[model samples]
Structures are given as structure tokens and as C-alpha cells.
Target: MPPPGQDPRWETMGLVHDYLAAEFPLINKTLSLAKVNTYGLIYEWTGTNSSLKPYILAAHQDVVPVNPETVSTWTHPPYSGFFDGESIWGRGASDDKASLTAIMLTLETLIQKDWTPERTIVLAFGFDEEASGIYGAKYLGKALEETYGRDAFAFIVDEGGGFKDVYETIFATPGVAEKGHADIKLEVTSPGGHSSVPPVHTTIGYLASLITEFEKNPYPVELARDTVPYDNLVCMAAHSRDIPRSLKRAIFRSGHSNAALHRFEKDFVLQDKFYSSLVGTTQAVDIISGGVKSNALPESAFAIINHRINTLSFVNETAARDTQTITSLAESLGLTLKAFGEDVIPESFYATSHCSSQSSSTSSSKGHIELSLAFNHELEPAPRTPTSGKESKPWDFLSGTIKATYYSHRAQGIKTETTATDGDNVDFDPRNVDGNTDTKYYWNLTRHIFRYNHKNAAYGSEIATGVHTVNENIPLDHYLEIIRFFTTLNNECR
Candidate 1:
């Protein structure tokens, strides 16, 4: 696969589409198929009732490229679809191909059975999701909006969260919200000179200090009620028996008492890095560059700090906090500051903030720091899908379908009949995705977007599954279960 912003492997993507067309002839013949931007696919299965809004089942065709260095370490060759009687081992087996194949197989089976839908079903398959979805989903989103108008779809199901065991209880978490994204570039400039005649601090030194300041002050994590993380906690507390008595009590009491919430955050949330990141904005200095030669003093140094903004916050808030973090240190170092194209610490402020005893010659030696958005890709948090009340009928229906699929998969071939009820062991919860998905582009198409694939994530280690790494594989039964889930969902849709 090509890197982000570069032209994708169009020929490679075409082969997958061609295979789909040949493999699922029934679906290809029945549905209205159109190719967007040469690779992105859209297939619409018209329904009997035009009054009801259509819903989308979305997946991506691309998978992260396999590293050649790790080929020898894989249990089977990365590209080889080796089925060891129980699981299929390949590069795209688990991350996304499973979902894509399941959706296609489900539709084909439904078509073979001569079943027509009351509500329309749309399938959106993008070609470059792994590379930030610029080449694929972006154009596809524009085409979809132009054809269907904004918010025309009832709901959209994309690849995301799945069922997993949390504290001994089985919970299915569908990502109803996704965090925002930003990449802030910090660049510092100084007078270049011989290394022997360098000033007290060079451009690289100032950049290091700024980075330290950012790490010193992280975004505070708060456990607010009605939020996705809090809701997940509530479900765990209500059903999971492995949680400690004190923590469980705190989680239950947190709804009504601020003191309990604080205790829970301090005791549980902060103690667990994963939970803390879920509730707070996260920052990481991902890229840095400095001097080219050892003999010369560096004239400039830059670093890009990536941020996954919290759902409750906006991009502007994150930028503001970044500016605030290094302002004092930059001023103390006699450096002028500019952030997001606005003058933060002007020349006058820099002159006044510096020590008066400093000579005029030293004033000319001061450098300037500039902060700006990197790559021009700044996105606000996605709108949270409604999970309750009258507007959440789609969510309710999906939840029921998930429960039914779980019960049926386990009770297959049994003589006894069973019904999915609230008392059943399974719990449905809404969760927030820390990273963005292709659904990021489809936000305008549907407010009821669910990032989910009904796969069980409790089977193996993340590395063993090879989602974006080596030894990628998926259990055969799990893949079949996904097909069953999608089939049941299509038939049960009202």
C-alpha cells in the first residue's frame, strides 16, 4: 500500500473489487453498483419501502502493509491465506478483510434465499483506509452526500469495537463516538554559527525544553456521568464480579456524588493508563529533526506533537493549552512566540520579559519559536450517536440483534429453544474510539453511526491476531459468526 497522500495502488485495489464481483455474482447482479474515484465502491440494495431511510454497512478494502523484515517470524507467510482447520492466517484476516468478506457473503446468501429488504441497505467499501482514508473515503463521502443529501441514512455500521471480556463479564462495546485529531508542529529558529561560538542555548536546546514542559503537564482526566467511558464503567460495575468492592461502590455512587467520582478517578482511572487515556486528551511527540552537520550550530529545530483530543474538548482548546504550556519557558529563554498564525509573544513582550542587564548585542541573539498546525489536518470530535430515547431505535435494534446473534451462535444445533432477554449474561455498552476510522468522513451522512463488527476480541493477543503486524489470523468460527451477525441484522431490520 502507498503512504498517506500518495496515489494508492489502484491496480491492487482493482483486483479485490474484481474478485468481489466474480465471487458474489448474485449481489453484483442485484445491487446498484458504482465506483467512486476509481476504487471506492458503493452498492445500494433498494428496499421495498422508500418511506424508511436507508442504513449503511461499511468496511474498507485496504490493510496495513506487511513488514518484509518480519516475514520469517510469521507462523505462515503474510500473504498466504493458510487455513489450519480452525483459523485463517493472512495479512488482512482479522483487521478488516473479515468484516468485508462477511458483509459480502451475508448479502450474497440473502440474495440467494430470495429475500428482499423493507429498508434499503448500502455497502460502502473504501480502498485506502489504512492511510488516513484521504484517497478513498474522502471522495466517497462527498459522492454519497451529493447523491443522498446530508443525514439521509438511518444508521451506519463500520469496522471498530467488538465484544471482549472485561472483569470476567462479557461486554459488547460499539464505538458510538470517536476522539478528535490534531498534529501541532513546533519549530524554533536561531542564528547559525560555528559550534565553538555557540550561545548558552541553541535552537535544539529550546525545543527540548518546550517538549519537556508539554510532558510535565498532561491533560487532566475527569470521570463525568453520561459519557461513554462512564457508561462503560457503569456496565462493568453492574455485571462484572471481578471488580474490587471499593471500586465498584465508587463507580455506582459516582453518578450522584462528586466526591465518589473524584475517588474513583484517583483510585482507578489514574491507576490504569488505558482508562486515563480514554477519558483525557493524549499527547505524544512523534517526530523531531535538528542540525544536519556536527560542526555547525543548528539554525532551526522542529518537532511534531500529535494529539488525540478528548471528546468533550475542541481543537481550539487543545491548541490554546499547548500555547499556554510553553509560553513561560519560551519567554524566559528570550524567545519570541507565535502560535496558529497569531503573535503570542511579540518582540515588545520579548524585549520587556528579558533581563534589563542584558547587553544590546545579546538582544540580537534571541531566537523565535513558531507553532502551527501540521499537514493541515485538524478535526473536531465526531457527534456522539444517540443511544437512548425515541431517536435511538436503530441502536436498540442493533443491540437486540447482537444479543440474538450471541445466543444463537452458542446454542447452535441444540434442541431446546432460547430467547435473548435482559437477564442474559451479555451486556451492551456504548464506547468511545481513541483513534479515528473511515466513519470520520461519513459523519455528515448519518448521526446514527456505529463503529462495530460483531467479532469476539477475547481470543488471542493483539500481536497474535496480526491486525497491523505479523502472524495475522482469524478463527474460522469467529468469521462465520460475523457473517451470521450481519445476516441476522439485515433480516431483522425494520
Candidate 2:
């Protein structure tokens, strides 16, 4: 909505913090709006957390940098927060700010009623999630681990919606696993030569051919990443009366179901659930750069490939193999993978790779392994290196919160744990509903995670698109609905 530097409109981050303090005293700890750099900010709202155990609900404030050309395409001004005939418009409105507002409102409402809980609640509002959450949530999450152990809170909830893109893809849509972005750089080098007296081959030419090979080869397509939570999909496919008989047979393998009927329709769009889960290895080239001048025979060429490794099993191996594959392909054209940067981590030609090294990976992979590598080699990935310290595993504390919340909301039709978010336009709320996908994060941690909020569901597709896009906005009605959802959830949990 605003240029890179300044936007006259909207509240400055400091003002937002101050406003929250003024709005409620029980947000009691006040807000910490900080910037380690000009571009990053991390904010925290500490209210009542259980001394016995803690809980966290996170939302981000910064929206994606906007594209001006596409600004006019929106129904309303992108940053205006304009309330037209129906929806409210503005950047960060839908993607996260709306959720932030809902969390704020829910907390403020509870505080006014003097509501306190058995578990402490930490409202972690991050800035720069759009920038991959490095300085914001990731940093804050690390802070918690440092202070209270890996399982600091019973759970942590962040930016995600409740439902699916289209109704047909899966019986239920859960944001079970987000593809962690593996940002990479592929570089090629060679001795420079004059273009006029060019040697038969130049570095740029070699690199160009390597790039072509990467493009021609994509990670073998796995229908859906297993991280998608196939169990939930199977659950939805089995007894969902909403599905037709022929379609249901293909989706679910019930006793009365015919495998043949589903075989022919295996290409069904809903099969994406199965496909995504089944795929463990995938490769993608994210960026490419090279060459010095048009008249010069460039000495080098390079490209960045973004790969999302399915799970820990193949990340390092796949990336190295792929990088080596690219190297071989390039060398065939006469080129190499020479890495730069003074602090380059000496990756093993024989070690595990971290393609999706985002917070989730850190938590899922490093949270335990890094802490225990030296002591427990079996737990560590291949080429196990010894670490100085010990690994800290996830706690059993989450089980209590899950059980408590489940019983608390059972009467309200909240059968969340095994359920997946399914349906576009569904009302998605994270605080107290099964409508969100945070369940998946715990699946690997706790063996099972479910949704407890049943009221409103929003398609993950719609919410996810708004995530790093221009005109990031959400409807006020949706905001109010979520606020209502949490308020009810809070009361039920009580």
C-alpha cells in the first residue's frame, strides 16, 4: 500500500502498541514493539500465563510489500481499510491483522471480565512474517525456548486459515504442514576471456546450459506432501455423507467401498491430499543471476533454487545430490557449485540437509536433534556430528492443554484433533477452534492434534494467498466472527 519508505496513512507500529496499552490494563505487561533492523519488528503482549504452564497465540502485523500496478485492481484501496458495501479493505487486514485484532479483542474482552486461566497465554504478535519470520516469530520463539524450554507454551499458533481451496480436493483441508522454503544459490565460475577473441566456451554459456537442465527436471511430482495429514483426509473421505457414493469410494476405503471405482478416478482433484503426503522429495529453482557485460565473455553464472524437502529423511541428501547433479550437468557444459560467503557452513557431501529451515523445521528437526546429537546418535540425522550440548524434546504439557480444551469445547461440537480444515470461505480462527491447522505441527510432536473450534471455517487457499500479497485485507464481519469464536471458546475452556 505504501512505498518502501513511508506511508502517511495507517498507525505506526509504536502507536499500535500504545493503543493496546491504553485499551486494556490487563494486557498488563504492555507491548514490546522492537526493531533489530530498519526492516524488522518483534512485538509481545504478555498477559496472564499459567505459572504452572504457558500457552501462546501468535499473529503478525506486517503485510507483504505491495505492487502498485495491481493496486487499482482491488475492490477497494489496498491500505485504505475501506468498508464498502460488505468487506473492509487494507493491507494486513485479512492475512493477519484481522487475526491480530480478533486476538486483541478476545483478550481485552476476557481481561475486562477478570478472566484468568490455569494456563498462561502469551499473545505473540510478530512483524515480518512475510519476510519469512526471521526477526519476528522465529526470533521470539527461540527466546521462549531459551527461557522456558522447547515446549514453552502448551501450543503456539500463527498465520494460517482453517479450510481448503476447493471442496473436491480432500474431505478435510488442514494446514498440516507448510512447505518450508529452502532458499538456495547456484553459482558457476570460470576464467574470463575477451568476447572478440573468445575461447570456444565461456562460464556464462556453461551456466546457461545447466539452468536448462534444472528447468527440464522437476522433483518427481508426489501427489501431495505426507505432511498434509492423510489420516484426516481419510477420515473425511470415509463417512462424509456430503460426498457422493462414486466419489466417496475413491476418497475413502470403507468396508463397503470398491477400490476399482476409485482407481479410475484416482486422478480426482481431491487426490492432492494423498499426493502431497506421499511426496518426500521435491526440487525447484528459485532464482538465477550471472554475467558481467554484454561485450565481455563472463567468467561466471549462477541461479538460486528453492526446494521444499518433504521430511527430514531426504533434505540434505536430495539437495546435495541435486546440487551435485546440477554441478555435473554444468561441468558437462564446463561449469562448478563454488559457494561464497566467509561463514559458509561446511555442509557434508554426506550429511542431512535442511531445505525448509524455517521455524517449523527448527522446532521439528533441531529442537530435539541439535540438543541430543552427541548423546543420541540414532536420533540425529546422518553423518552425525557431536554437539556440545544436549537436546531438549517437546513436553507432555501439551497433552493437558489438548485434553482440557477438548473437554471444554466438546459440547460445542468441537471434535478438532483429527479433523482437517475443509472448504473455501470457511471461517478460520486459531485461538479456540479446530478450524485452524496448528494441529499438524503437534502431530509429529504429540502423535495426534485436532481442531476444537467448529463454528467458522475459511479456506486455507484464500487466506494463504493474502499472506504475502498486495491489498492484504480481511472482512470486518470475519473479524467479528472470529472474535466471537474465541470469546465462546474462552468461556467453554473456563
Candidate 3:
């Protein structure tokens, strides 16, 4: 690919495709494999022939469009592919471009080093992943099942994991499961009337009151804390049992006494600001409208409150549906409810059809597991009890990966535990489940779904900044760290 001489967006896709598919062969592949607007382009690289099954390594090539004028805001050119001493800079530097570069650079280096593993390593670059990968990865995944049985992949690596911090230090965390998206829009309407002859409360007034009420205390459903974060944290803290112990103790004791007041306050705030928000239900009012104009006295005001649940259920978790229920309870007094954008609710069209939820450690899954899901796939909340699938099993695969790579850096030979990063008590604060990508696609399949990114490094609060904003930035050092992660992963991929 050209070394960022020109803005890559125009010819960038073609160049990337050529490099991965034709030029270096591995690095430059397909620009749009699916070839459909929804599917986007793709590039694939096959590993050297070997008896072992292949591993699917994925990263999307399509980047979020940048502001044409302010592109210079990038310290290093977004597409320069330049490695500054401080850090490599670019758009998608952290969100996913870093991940993409990692695999690309790893393969380029490995191929040059004349290294070939026992398994066929499949490196895929999707063109349209920035839009949730419906076409790129999803379509490729379908093709894989058709070509090889469902179990063809030993494992697949997507942008689920990234480097983060446990305390003030950098902690490399891998995502095992991401919360699913359940969008709920609570719309409240009241009798529309003129400002001159108001009915005590307008629709906007009523909806605002309902929102105020919901805000008093979010729905209190529990989230299943995926064992992965805890494992990473324990490892990050060097297995210091004291930290988590103190944190957990605080969670329990905060409710009981004033004696532990200070301890509880400090600990609760940290936990709430750090880990608790990741796995939970969250709500926010993004839009609302009721009146048409001034003077004439319009009727009807509506509040559109968006909600996402951290429940085990696939895409569109509890809060999306529960918003209505919450509104219903508050409506009898005179408020009306209506949710807009319900039509845009995500539909799951595919499932891990070949794999079985019943597979045991020793069980072999069917050759192919892909199923079609309807657009309006309203999944029932999974059993309150957690369920595990071989595809989505949170176990040594995750913990082992982290341990093998970064563990050696540690002084102690401590072992780490792995579990799905689900919401055990998500509803406690609805913020965790807001209409966000954290758990959107995860709710649909039983595969491992983890939501993590590098930006959290700067935000001491560990809150997600709803992706794509003017201030979107990640540390250059962290960007390099993620690149190194791919280096470690490829070296250790089993």
C-alpha cells in the first residue's frame, strides 16, 4: 500500500485489497469479499498447508471516515503506516486499525521469517466492520461453515480483547463475552394542549417525570460477571487476593454499616467506576419531541429513552424491552408511552448452527453450525443460570492466551482464571446496557463475546465514549501495545 502519500479512503480500499490479496498476498487481499453494500469487502490469507485445522484471525480494513479538513489532528498521519518512536499514529489506531495492523505486520514478518505453523492460519480483513460487520465477518463466517464443517476453526480472533488497566498500571485484558444489545425506547405522551390552556402536565412533562423516576433507581437486574475480567484483574494485581477481596467486601459491607463508611465509599466508587459498569443495564434519554410549533399550542410531547440490557439473552437485551414495562407501571397516573425506532431494533440473521450447547469437553461438534435468524429475532432472556457452549466457553483458551504471553513478564508463575464477561448484576445501573456496541452482537450467538477497547486507559472512570466522536483519541503507547498483542497472539495461537 502507498505509505500514506494521499488520503487512503479513495483508493485505500483497492490498495488494501491488492496488498493483502495480490501484492504481499497475505497482507493485501480482498477489498469487498461479500461485494454487497451491507456485506462490505474482505481479504483472506491462508496459512501454509498442514494437517491441523485453520484458525481464523480477523480485523476490518474499512476505517471510519475522517473529517477531510482536520485530518491533520493526527500526530502521525492516519494512513502513514509510520511507526514513530513514541507510537504509530493513524485513524482506527486503537478501535481496530491497530488490531488490523498487528495481524498484517505479524504475518508479513512471519512469512519473511519462513515460519509456518501446523495449522492453516486464516487472516481475514473485512471492509465494512465499522458498521457492525454484518457483511464482512458475518458473510465470511458463513462461507467458512460451507467450505469446512462448523468445527473447521480451532479458534477465531476478533477485536474482542485489548490492553487496559486494573489499577493505575496497564493491564492487558481479553474480552470473553460482550453484553448483548436489547434496545428499549420508552416513549411517554400526555394529552397535547396549548401552552395557554395547559393540562397541568404535557406529554413532554409526563415523559420527563417518568425518566426522572427511572433515573432515581435503574432496573435492578443482576449481571453475570464474566470470569475473564476478574481473571485479568487478579493477574494484573499479580494475584493479590487483597484487592478483589477488599472490593468484594466493600460491595457487601457498603449496605450494612457506617463504621466501614469510608472504606465502602472509596471502594464502591472505584468498583462502580471501573468494573461494575461493564456488565449491566443502562438507560439514557437521547431524543424527545412533542410539540410542533410555538403560539398555536401543540399537543403531545414524547421522550425517547434508549435502554440496553446486560442479560445473557442475545442481541437486544432486557432494557430494550423492559423500557416499555417501566413506562407502563408509571403510566396509569395519566402519562402515555410510545417507543420510536423500534423498527431499527437489530435482527439476528445467523447463528452458530453447527455447534451444540450440549457439547462437553470431550464432545466433537457438528462439522458446520450456521442457522438463519429472522430480522425480528427477539430472543427470550437466556436462563438466569449461565449456559456455556464450546464456541463461547470462557476458559483456559482466554486465560491461557493472556498467561502465556504476558504472564512470563510477571515475577510469579501465577495462573489466571477465565470466564465469560457477562453481566451478573447489570441492571443495578442502566448505564452499562445503554444502546451501545458493547454487547450488541454478542447476544445473538453462543460464541465468546467480549467488549473492550484502549480508550478506557485515559478515562479513569472506565466509561465507554459511545465511539466515533471529535475527541476520540487513544494513547500512542497503548496503540503500540495492542500491536504487540497480535505479535504475541500469532506466536502462541494453538
Candidate 4:
């Protein structure tokens, strides 16, 4: 995979393309492979039955840039692609190169076996996903729409939630949905004055109070069993033997004893780092600026609040609610404020109006407060992929392949260890991915978008698939398991 923010060279992709063009001449002649937007690669293995909508296996061919200062800290060089007799160490080893390799190898194997599908299969690889898909999946999605039309895919699969052991049981978590993202900007302006003669609170001081309010009153938490994350906990409780019986019973009877279920989830499930993100919209005051000089009270203050909207709420709604909360808080603090974005006045007009309205209070109205949400990029919560009913065939096939990948080894008198005890068969759990993937750009192509990558570890061992960090690597055995899963899924997805 090429490093992030660069052109979609897809050096690995080009190599695979050339190899297939030479080795599998028949496949080269039959399947349609094209580079979309000069960066995204799309390979379509046309099916005998054109009536069936195609299935897309999507993965990216880009990795985040490694910090130069951290180079000496790595066991192997970041881009060395070293095999240390146990795992492959490199920057993109686990994140996405593994998935790309698995897809190409699976296709090559299928072509060698002379295998043909009844339904079409598409392999879509985006090259600039790490830099936010502007040049890759976004254009690929548009090209696909022009070629295959909207809703032309049976399902789209991408790298996201993976199989992991939790509570002594393997949970095959295919990310059925993902959280939305937004960046809100807050600003305040006041009459400039000498620091010695300033009011009780300056513009920066009011901004600080607003930030405190946001932290004190975060988005409300919901633990209803119907929610995706809570439901997943319920599924885990039902399958894992390590969970307390009382907690399992509370989860099972969540609908009947709502308070008990909420308490149990808040005390137990939310304690985990992964599950804490799912319950509510998370707010972080990531950036702040104020005060230009030590001798003068600054006239302006600015802050940027980043939010990850939970699957339970819509992005627009979450933003609106937060705007209201901030506006109310500012008003309570005796600050004359005007909110921005959705039902709030335009920033230019609001600032101008405030500039004209002279001295409403003894302290010149305790400074004019401005709340605006200038979203750098915003995305709504992804559509939830179905896990039940006839339309869930793709999910069922993917889960079955994961199960088969681990279970086949056990059947051969091989000991397979998950986070669970040896010989414990892992079960599948449908849940939303906490992080976003390239699949976000392809939502228009299909409702059945699944974000999954295989990564369950043996009990007491580290899950070494560290993304965007130093010492990134993937266990060789786990890499093989990924390939096996993809091979099985490729053959069975129809």
C-alpha cells in the first residue's frame, strides 16, 4: 500500500493486475478491470447470471504516514516489509495491505481453480483512503454509479470491525454501521480594554465557561437493549461463560427491567474502552485560541469542538442539540450570544448586528458571545447492515466463512485459541464499527455495506494489529487466516 496523501499509485495493485493479465489469460479476457479516476481500481468478475446484483469486496491500498522521530523505536523498519519468523512487520501490514493481498490472492486462486460464480463479484481498492477518500473511493463510487447504476450491488464489504475475543469468547464483529463525524467552531468577541480594567470575565474567560458546560453536560447516554452496542453486549452475555449470571440475566431481561439493564451496562460494558464510544455523541475541545497580548484583554476567542456522533443519533440532530445547549449555557452566563448553523443567524449578519448594538449592559453586555459550527467535514451515521431475514445472505456468508476458517483447524485435532479457552467455538455478533472506513463513501451503492477484518487473538496474547502507530505488525498465521476467510467468502458469496 502507498503511504497516505499521495497519488493512488497502487504499486501492489499494478503488479497483481499485470500478473493476472499474464497468468490468467481467460480471466483477463472475461473480467472487466478498470482504474477509476486514475487512482481507484475496480475489477469485476462478471457472473453467468446478470440478473443478480453484484457483490463488492472493498479495501484500501494506503497507510498513514509514520513519524520520522519514532523510526528507531520499531523492531523492524516501518517500510521494510520484514518477516521475523512469526509476523510481518511494516506500516501497512495489518491495516489494509493484508486485506488487499488477501483479495488478490483469493482471486488468483479462484481463477487457477477455473471457478466461476453464479453472481458477479467486484474487487474495489481505493488508494487514498487514509487521506479521506477524495481521490479514491469517492471517485470510485461515482464511476460505479455511472457504470452499474445505484443500488447495483448485493453488498459492499470493507476493512472495519474485526473478529476479536471478548469475555473468553470469540466475537465475529462485522461493522454493520459506523459513527458520524463533525467539527464545530465556537467564537466570541468582546470590546478590547486594558487587562487591569477588564470585566470579571473576558472573551476567553466566557469561552472557558462554555467548554466547562459542554464537559459537564455531555450527550445523554442510552443503554436500551435495542441499540446496536447494547444488543451486542446482550449477545456476548448469552454466549460467554465468564460473565456474571446476574449481569447476564439483566441483559437478557433488559426490556423488562430497564433500570437494572442500564445500570449494568453503564457499570460493566461502558467500562471497556471500545464500548464507551457507542453510548453517546463524544465531544472533545481539541483546539482553542485567545489573547494576543499580555497587557490587553483580547477581543476575540475561538475554539474547535470535535464530535463523533453515535449510531443512535443523526449527525444533523446531534449538531443542533449541541448548538442549543451551548447557546443556553452562554445566555445563562449573562453573555449576549447568537448561535450559528441551523435555525441560528448567519455569522456575518450576527457579528454585524452585535457590532451595531451598542452598550446593552453596564459592562458593555458582558461581551458578545458567538457560537458557530463550521464543520470541516460532516457525515451522517451509516446505514445499518441487516443481520436477519433473506436479504442478510452476504452477512451470513461472511460470518460462516470466519467460523469455518477457525473451526476447520479444530476439526483436524489442532488447538485453536481465541480470547476464549482452547476449543471454544466463536460466535458471530453484528455491531457498529467505532471507527469509519472507506465504505462510508460507497453507501450510495448499497445498503448492505459491511466493515470487517479478521483479527481474533489467542488468550493472553497481544492483538498486534496496531494501526497508525509504531511497531505495527500482523501475525503470519493470522494473515493466512484472513486469506482463508476471503477465499471461502469469495466462493460462497453468491
Q: Give the winner by TM-score: 2 or 3.
A: 2
Model 1 CA lDDT for position 182: 98
lDDT of 2 by residue, 1-494 (tens): 44224644434655665655676665545444444333334344443544544555666667766788888777667777787645567776766677777777787777677766545555556555655454455555555555556544544444453433233332222232343324456555566767888766566566566667777766554333222333334455554446567656655543234454345235653346445333434455556666768788776666666555543444445545555455444333422234322212222211334333444333221100000011111111111111112421111222233333323443355433223333311211111111222222222222122233221242332332254565455544455555655565445432
**What number of clashing residue pairs does each candidate have, in the order they appear?**
0, 39, 59, 0
- Indicate which candidate wins on lDDT: 1
- Better candidate by lDDT, 1 or 2: 1
* lDDT scores of the candidates, listed in order: 0.87, 0.45, 0.45, 0.76
| Candidate 2 error regions (>4 Å) | 1-12, 22-52, 72-74, 164-174, 197-201, 222-229, 242-247, 251-280, 336-467
Pick out the ten consecutive residues of candidate 1 with the lowest summed lDDT: 414-423
Candidate 1 residue-wise lDDT, 202-247, digit = tens: 8899999999999999988987888888988998888885778887
Model 3 global lDDT (CA atoms, 0 to 1): 0.45
Residues 1-494 of candidate 3: C-alpha lDDT, one tens digit per residue: 21222434445566765565554554443211433233334343445555656666666777777677866665545556565554444566555666666667677777677765545666555665665555455565555555556556555566654443334344444444444443334444334445788655555565566667667766543322343323333243443223566655644453455655445444443346445444445556676665687743434444544444454444433534444445434433422222333322111211222224433344331111111122332333222212235433333444445544443322233322211123211000001222223123223232433333222242242222213533234445455445455566666654
Q: Ten residues in a row with the worst lDDT in model 4?
A: 343-352
Query: What's the CA RMSD for each of the models?
Result: 3.0, 12.3, 14.7, 4.5
Best of the two (3, 4) by TM-score: 4
